[model samples]
Target: MRLKGKVALVAGAGTGIGAATARRFVAEGASVVLTGRRPGPLAEVAADLGEAALAVPADMADTAQAREAVRAGVERFGSLDVVIANAGGHGGNAVADTDDEDWRLSIESNLTTCFVTCREALPALVESKGAIVVVSSIAGLTAGPAVAGYVTTKHALVGLTRSIARDYGPRGVRVNCLCPGWVRTPMADEQMDELVERDGITRDEAYALVTKDVPLRRPATAEEIAAICLFLASPESAIMTGSVIVADGGATAVDLPTLAFA
Candidate 1:
């Protein structure tokens, strides 16, 4: 009931964290507008949410489509109370081998999409004094061997969120970023399989190796991430703004061992 009578727009709502956030929002009494590249998956989620959900198929990378998606949501729900810029992907490329195309694509997919959606939704959010929750990643804070493009783009979002929050918090618009670690989503599963094939290891071994740095010894669940987003979107976090909340199971807290010391 925290979101009762609120209107929310969730991008990338076809699966994973986006889908989980949509479902959680609807359950809390918010009428949701769910958008994703695939119409089938969006429609399925909307159907499951009953009358409170609207499925709007869109590719967030397209600036025009992203703007129209926000506009359509406002048209249906009368006003917009929350916006979740959750559409992004990881492009695997080492810094040495990354091409301009790969870097640009990663920027467009992760950072540009959030920029477009937030710009489009700003007017409506200002009118309603709503909150914006951006879904970033733990890679934004820590470094890895590969995924240079992904790491940079995710880090860029944190900066953008803070800037927007600083400028608009006085105007009653709250903006925050949620940085999640490895989560058991379809995308994570694909990454795990790719590691297995690349490293010639069993699936279990691949998962364990990847999560070895995490103190929890396992990845987070989609619902767990959704719950955090819900709290941020609700009045419970009214005093919170320009915050970077990390849900990484302490993966980034561990220090790498020095060769000389070892």
Candidate 2:
């Protein structure tokens, strides 16, 4: 077990990558504290992980709630050794179409949550010389169509990762950011459903259309993303910090000008 005696706080552990990471962490012998806005999903995941997991329902974007989640984790586990800041959401249209509400929501979910989680967990992490894996999106490095708020907040996350790593490195906390292109999570299924409705296509076809030019020609699975998180959180990545690791199935490697030739 790579994380045999570690304790991890998974900020958005209710579903998708967060849930997968929680399960993986437990498998690696880590005690995980699960937090999210949804109580039901958090409880379900905690139940599945048995005693190795604790469920704490909280809106991580809120400072008070975020602090409480961290406190609860440390109270139960005695120490916090890792953090998976995976709480985020998709929102907004193009800049011209995005309203204040949409922009605010996107910032709160995608940016504030990570910031608050890390802020609250920093002391514990420093104490344990722990690592943090910030779950960003490929959108952080490159823009996608008509998602101004998502693009902006994701880009901001990269900067946040670097800043935290730089500031905390001396304190023995390693921080890294993960940018996945498209993962087949419930959130992404929602986006695919939109394409299905607009193009009269099946959900599978919708996903295919989006990833047709990607070298892998398919979206990633949550479990696949979780594996990367595991590495970042474990001793395997002890020497790494302030790194932006892209796991996009080669989507960002292609030149749009050369796609037509393919």
Candidate 3:
């Protein structure tokens, strides 16, 4: 309800956090334009949200498509009050195993998409004095094992968030990064499958294996992350900008040696 009368552009809205955010925004009395690479899922989400939502399929990694998504959203919704750059994915085997394409795709999906979304939405966002909540990862704040390309791109999003916030804060646009740890989403599910296959373990075992380091002892739900995005997108987080908010179940708070003692 905090976002009553607002309009938001949510990239990667085909599913997971993006879909969840679109739902949350609608429930809070906002009009949402959902954009993603997949039209099927995006259409499904748009249908679910009824008249409050519109789906536009766009690959945010491309500048032209990113611009068009914003344009279409504005044309339908009249103005933009928030932009959620929630599109991203993992890449690379490890630093030693990663190839050029791995790095390129990772950067495109995770970092470039975010930059392009913010760039295209800034003019409208400035007019509306709106907010931009970028979805980075806990890896952005701290390194993770065997995900070199993902780690690099997420870390870069932190810088992008801060830079955007600093440059545009005085212009009435707010920018902040959400550093989420493990979450129960399609991306995380894919990673779980990879872990299971790589280690020859069951699905539950793979989940526990990855979540053992989390203080909460489980992965976050997409709704949980979306709730934070709602807060950041609303006036409740008015005092916060350029903040790297970590909602990782305390994964980054513990010292590795301390964990060993535990």
Candidate 4:
């Protein structure tokens, strides 16, 4: 029980990495307050965790809602020891193809949500000398094809993580960023569906095609990313802060030129 007697507020805890992280934290003896835009899934996850989880459905991008979520967690658990800012969505299309609405939604979904949620959770975290894990994307460090909005917002999250770490380090709050590549989540399934439709290939084949150049030759599972979040949130990484962790199956390690040879 690495997190025994701890309390965690996990934004976007309804599905994918967030849900897996919530489950992992609970298994490690941490109570979690789960918040997300979807009420049904959020409630389901919370219910599954029994008394250890509280479901709060709200958009983290909304300042009032974000603050309320933090307040609710602290009130329910008596203290907040960790935060997982895992709320984000993909922004489709290239720069020229992306309309203003798409760009704005991407910023709100991927960046504003984390910014607002973390900002609200800072006071509680400072009191507990807790940690904040910002769930960025591999796109934060490198670009993906035709996802300019996603790439931009994700990259901005890295800067956000560093800035928060620097500003709050003296206050005893550790902030770190997690960048995962091609995680096998419901969101990724949509991308696979696109490929399947376009190429007349199976979903598994699409995933394989996408990860062909990756050293692991496979996409990461949500549980795998959740394990990394557990490390960052637990005392295991006590001395770590302002660090950007890449869990991309070695996708970023390969040189594009060398991939041709491989």
* Prediction-by-prediction clash tally: 0, 0, 0, 0
What are the TM-scores, per candidate, against the unseen true structure? 0.94, 0.98, 0.96, 0.98
From the highest lDDT down, the ranking of the candidates is 4, 2, 3, 1
Query: lDDT of each prediction vs. the true structure?
Result: 0.91, 0.94, 0.91, 0.94
Q: Write the per-residue lDDT of candidate 4 for residues 74-181, one digit (tens) a residue.
A: 899899999999999868799999999999999999999999999999988999999999999999999888999999999999999999999999999999999999
The per-residue C-alpha lDDT of model 1 at residue 243 equals 98
**All-Cα superposition RMSD per candidate:** 1.9, 0.8, 1.3, 0.8
lDDT by residue (141-162, candidate 1, tens digit) is: 8866789999999999999999
Lowest-sum lDDT 10-residue window in model 1: 253-262
* Lowest lDDT 10-residue stretch of candidate 4: 253-262
Candidate 3 stretches with Cα past 4 Å from truth are 198-201
In model 4, pairs of residues that clash are: none
Q: Could you give candidate 3's per-residue lDDT for residues 19-114 as a string of tens digits?
A: 999999999999999999999999999999998998989998888988898889889889999999999885657888998888888888899999
For candidate 4, the per-residue lDDT at 225 reads 96
Model 4 root-mean-square deviation: 0.8
Residue 132, model 3: Cα distance from true site in angstroms: 0.0
Residue 162's lDDT within candidate 1 is 96
